[model samples]
Target: MIVSLIVIVVIGIWLMSMYNGLITLRNNVANALRQIDVQLKRRHDLIPNLVSAVKGEMKFEQETLEKVVQARAAAMSVKPGNMKDLAAKEGELTAALGRLMMLKESYPSLKANEEVNKLMEELTHTENQIGFSRQFYNDICTKFNTKQQVFPTNIFASMLGFKPEELWELPADSPERENVKVDLSF
Candidate 1:
C-alpha cells in the first residue's frame, strides 16, 4: 500500500512539471510573436511618411503608391492573434513595398530625396528585425508544438486544453516571394 502511494505521488509531480513546462513554452511563443508585431507596427508607421515624401516626385507611379497605401491599411486592420490573416496581409504589404522600391530606378529624383531615403532605410531595418523575430517565434512555436505532441506530455497537454499554435509562414505561392521587376527606361 505504501509503495502504491509513493508511485502515485511521483506521477502527480511529473504531470505537474509537464503542465508547467508547456505553459512556459506557450508564453514564450506569445512573447516572440509580440516582438514581430512591434517591428511590423514600426514599419507600418514609416510608410505614410515615405509615401508623402515621394508623392510629388513619382506622379507617374501613382499605381505603385496606391498599392502600398492599400496594403498598409489592410495590414493595419489585422488583429493580434490572427496569425494566418496577419501573415497574408504582411506578405501583401511586403510585395507592395518592394514594388515601391523598384520605382527608385525609374525615378532618380525619388532616390535623391533625403527624407524618402531616410524613411526607406528605417523601413528596411525594421523588415530585417521582423524577419529575425519571425524566425524566433517559429522556433518557439515548434518547441511548444513538439512538447504537446510527445508521448506522456501529449496526454497531459490535451487534458489541460492547450492547443497548438500556427506558425507565421508566408503562403507557398505568395507573390511577395517573387523578385521585384524594375523598368528603368524612361
Candidate 2:
C-alpha cells in the first residue's frame, strides 16, 4: 500500500512538471507574438505621417496613398489572437507601404522633404524589428508545438488541451512574394 502511494505521488509530480513546462512554452509564444504587435503598432502609427508627408509630392499617386490607407484600416481592424487574419492584413499593408515608399524615388519633392525622410527612416527601422519579432514568434511557436507532440508529453498534451499556434507566413501568391520591379527611368 505504501509503494502504491509513493508511485501515485511520483506520477502526480511528473504530471505537474509537464503542465508547468507546457504553460511556460505557451507564455513564451504569447510574449513573442506581443513583440510583433508592438513593432506593428509603430508601423501603423507611422503610415499616416508618411502618407501625409508624401501626399502633396506624389500628386498623381492617389491610388497608392488610398491603398495604403485602406490596408492600414484593414490591418488595424483585426482582433488580437487571430494570427492568420492579422498576418494577411499585415502582409497587404506591407506591400502597399512598400509601393508607396518606392514612389519616393519617382517624386523629387518627396526625396527632398525632411519630414518624409525622417518618417521613412523610422518606418524602415520598425519593419526590421517586426521581421525579427516574427521570426522569434515562429521559433517559439514551433518549440511549444513540438513539445506537446513528443514523447510521453504527447499523450498528455491534448488531454490538457494545448493547441499548436499558427505561424506568420506570407501566402504563396502574396505581392510581397513577388520580385519588386524597380523603375529608374526618371
| Candidate that would win on TM-score | 1
Candidate 1 positional error at 27, Å: 0.9
The TM-score obtained by model 1 is 0.89
Candidate 1 residue-wise lDDT, 1-186, digit = tens: 999999999999998889889889999998998999899999988998889988998888899999999999999999877888889899999998888876675677767878878888888898889889999999999999998999978777878999999988998777787776655686
For each candidate, the alpha-carbon lDDT, in order, equals: 0.88, 0.89
Q: Could you give the C-alpha RMSD of every candidate to the true structure, in order shown? A: 2.3, 2.2
* Least well predicted 10-residue stretch by lDDT in candidate 2: 101-110
Clash count, candidate 1:
0
Off by over 4 Å in 1: 179-186
Q: Give the top-scoring candidate (lDDT).
A: 2
Candidate 2 achieves a global lDDT of: 0.89
| Tens-digit lDDT track of model 2 for 95-157 | 998988787776777778788888989988998899999999999999999999899999999
